[model samples]
Target chain A: MFTLYEFASSGNCYKLRLAMAQLDIPFQRIEKDITRGETRSAEFLAINPNGRIPVLVTPDNRVLPESSAALWYLARDSKLMPEDPFQQAQVLQWMFFEQYNHEPNIATSRYWIHVLGEQEKYAEALAEKQQKGHDALAVMETHLSDRDFFVGRDYSIADIALYAYTHVAGQGGFSLDAYPAIRGWLERVERQPGYVAMEA
Target chain B: MFTLYEFASSGNCYKLRLAMAQLDIPFQRIEKDITRGETRSAEFLAINPNGRIPVLVTPDNRVLPESSAALWYLARDSKLMPEDPFQQAQVLQWMFFEQYNHEPNIATSRYWIHVLGEQEKYAEALAEKQQKGHDALAVMETHLSDRDFFVGRDYSIADIALYAYTHVAGQGGFSLDAYPAIRGWLERVERQPGYVAMEA
Candidate 1:
């Protein structure tokens, strides 16, 4: 009974869709085209003042924005979220890292290059983003080298949060060839039950 | 029983120190000077490959990084975090907004201008950051206009997360004259029990 306002191509939006699919939660999807100014409209602003997509309206009509918050809401008390307090904090640590470290560089670069098709105009910004994006991936690679998942040996929402942008990093001009551990981990996440791919 | 690796002036690191004080938790503080490259040392990198401070080593010697994650851990069972699932998500929503929308612009600009003293070299980036920082403040003003706090009726870590960078936004060249609601909210948070100010 949840209604999700999203932009399909956005990895932030995709994180919620993928999480719902894995949790077997039935929800309605309403596409908001940012390029066409759908998200900035007065009507959409009423739903989320932030004017961003991937907002989840609950069955009771409460509006929840922010994809990572939505993922934590949907997965809490489920196996996707750990029971241990420390483990839960660890999962949150990675989710915060995805938002703070990974998304700004990887997702923003992908939007500029792939969706907006303005790579030349954003050349300078993209260069800085590419370097930082690789640094984020390197951190993930090192973490994954000794662990199969970002948290406590399980496929949690932390995996979903990081996976959304990372799987499509090439769209942002990032190469995965050097990250063997990340590659293996990506495949492991894909093998999880009810896993859904990001739509084109 | 806890060891905190932090940078004294960083709002991100200060969030942890402030939270621990409000919660009445005792911990040892170890300051790592990022300007002096303390965070990038091989020894520091071993604890957090991300090479960032505000890392909390738990009583069991488990290392945890990321300021928001540390806030969640320290406040999980306390009144600082809500028990209701929906309220908890709302708290997290604001926390994410602080990290994604607020911090990057406000905190980064402050670092460049105040700490690094390189406003001239980062002029172009600072201009963009200033605009976005104002936008983020606008969003908070709208939200706070109708509520006493970010989530529910009580103060939570969401306020702490946002308050960290915002209280000193003037250092980043952002004026608070237009944000009356945010100004009032800041005072309310300062009046909270056990509240601690960021160290000089």
Candidate 2:
């Protein structure tokens, strides 16, 4: 069995859980709370020098960190990944967009507000992320305006990457009311086969 | 021929130029000045809703943005990309790391100080990024201490992704004197075949 180091409440970690469940890949998860500094423990740091969670240890004991990388690893030769080379790159396009543009703003805001209860402390940073977060959502809204998914009009890891944080953006004080296309896509993602709701 | 929209000096844009040069993929270039707000122009926004450079239009007219994604597209079936499944995921691991940890801290610092000439204006933010950039460099140092390349000990897109910002980190006030391993890796990258220097 594969071993997963994760914080249950984290969307990044949840991306792996959701994918493994969807792919029917079995793995045992060990919860490491980031807020409590569990991830900073020397043992945890040994697995990932980066000191982040959602690390996957392959059955052969090969360790991999970074949620998208782990997800890409799990999606290989599976339906979650595309066969077309261009579509595969398109999957990467949105995954990078999520990490660079979306997650930093959207996910961090949620971590500050909902997870850490530090909305007041991070108010200034939160304010700055607000506009950028919406810019990312607007990009998604426009893209999804015509297509059902981010690439090849199919639900792939790109969708999973974005959906991890987007579904709970309201927790970060982001109102998705104006993004009809994004809302529509979120609903479509929830209905995919073997889709498991993120555990609270 | 492909059409590359870029800001010539940007490491992100340079990634494509370098990759295409090494891979022997020819493309026409159009320079867009981010400092002058060229990327925010409507024409540019229509091409890339994210308002970023390093957008590539394939010969068939398919538009792909995000530097790593474009690199993956160009590296298809090439030596720059590994064929092994796990190694491919490892490549994605470092590329994502470049986008998240390295670029935001290191490259953004270079942009503000070196390109935009606003060191005084961004002093506080620059200070904050300094620690993070070094932290990223530290992680790289540890990883490269034993390995010549990032994945499979080969010059893949993973190295290209990090080298773009890292090689010129000095311009952003990052000192490589303490990082012997990283220095060695950078020199190794410079020695790769078909390498073309980024035009200033």
Candidate 3:
């Protein structure tokens, strides 16, 4: 059996849970409270020296961390991944955008504003973060304007990567009202086959 | 023919160029001056609404952007990508690390200290950037102490992503002396077949 070390509130951890659910793959889950520094413990450090959540340990004793990487691992040769070369790269393109443009802005804001509750200390960085965050959202809005899904008219890991955090972006102070296309796309992803809510 | 739009100094763009050279894939190169805001031009924005560099236009008129995505596009079904499902995900793990931990610290510092010439403005941020940058380097140091490459024993996209900026990290005011393993690994990558150097 696969074992996943996950954090309940982390989108990165949620990605693994969501993928496992969608694939109907059973796994033992060990929840680490990231807020309490549970991931930094010696035992957990042995699993992933990076001290991060969502470390997926395979049955063969291979440990794979990083949510996107875990998604690729679980979905390879399965219906979750695209067989076409170009289509697969498109999925990666969106995933990279999620990391570079999307996550840095949205995730940072979430950490500072919501997690740390340090609006005053991080006040200067907030404007830049908000601008970059909005820019990322704008790009996503444009791309989703004409698509039912991120790639090949199906829900792939790309959707999983982006959806993990985007659905909860409102908690980070981003308004969904301006991004109608993204909002619509979010609904479509929620209605996907075998879909499971983050906490459900 | 593959047409690549990139700037000389972008490590992300360098990843694609390095992969293309390794694959022996011939392509036309179009230089985009990211520093002067050329990526934001109306024409460039038409091809990539995100207006980012390292956009690859394939023969079928499909445009693939983002460095990691483009590398996968070029290496898909080739010997560059591992056929094993788990190993391929291992590659993605390092690639994601390159994005989240490595790029944010090392790449951002290089862009700021070396390219932007805004050291004073970035004083506090640079301090934090250096700490995080060194932390990431330590992670690579520990991983490389035992293995030749990041994923499998063979060279893959994982090396391409990290090596692009790492060799030139000194330009970002980072010291390689502390991480002997990473330093040695850089040499190993440099000695690889079809290895290419980023512009000095």
By TM-score, is 1 or 3 better?
1
- Candidate 1's displacement at residue B64, Å, is 0.7
Q: How well is each residue in B7-63 modelled by candidate 3, as lDDT tens digits? A: 888999889888889899989989998889999999999899999888999977899
Clashing pairs in 2: none
User: Going through the candidates in order, what fraction of the true interface contacts does each contain?
Assistant: 0.87, 0.93, 0.95
- Model 3's CAPRI class? high
Better of 2 and 3 by TM-score: 2
Candidate 3 lDDT tens digits, A1-200 = 99999977778778878888889999998889887899889998888888887899998889998888888889876787898888888988898899888888887787778777887888788777888889999998988888888888888999899998899888677888999999998998889878878762
Ranking by DockQ: 1, 2, 3
DockQ of 3: 0.88
Stretches > 4 Å off in candidate 1: none
Task: List TM-scores for all candidates, in order.
Answer: 0.99, 0.99, 0.96
Quick one: best DockQ, which candidate?
A: 1
- Tens-place lDDT per residue, model 2, B1-200, is 99999998999999999999998898999999998999999999999999999899999999999999999889968999999988988999999999999999999999999999999999999999999999999999999999999999689999999999999999898999999999999999999999988776
Overall lDDT per candidate, in order of appearance: 0.94, 0.93, 0.87
Q: Please, what are the lDDT tens digits per residue for candidate 1 over residues A1-200?
A: 99999998999998988888988899999999998999889999889999898899999999999999999999999989988999999999999999999999999999999999999999999998978999999999999999899999788999999999899999999999999999999999999999989986
Inter-residue clash pairs, candidate 1: none
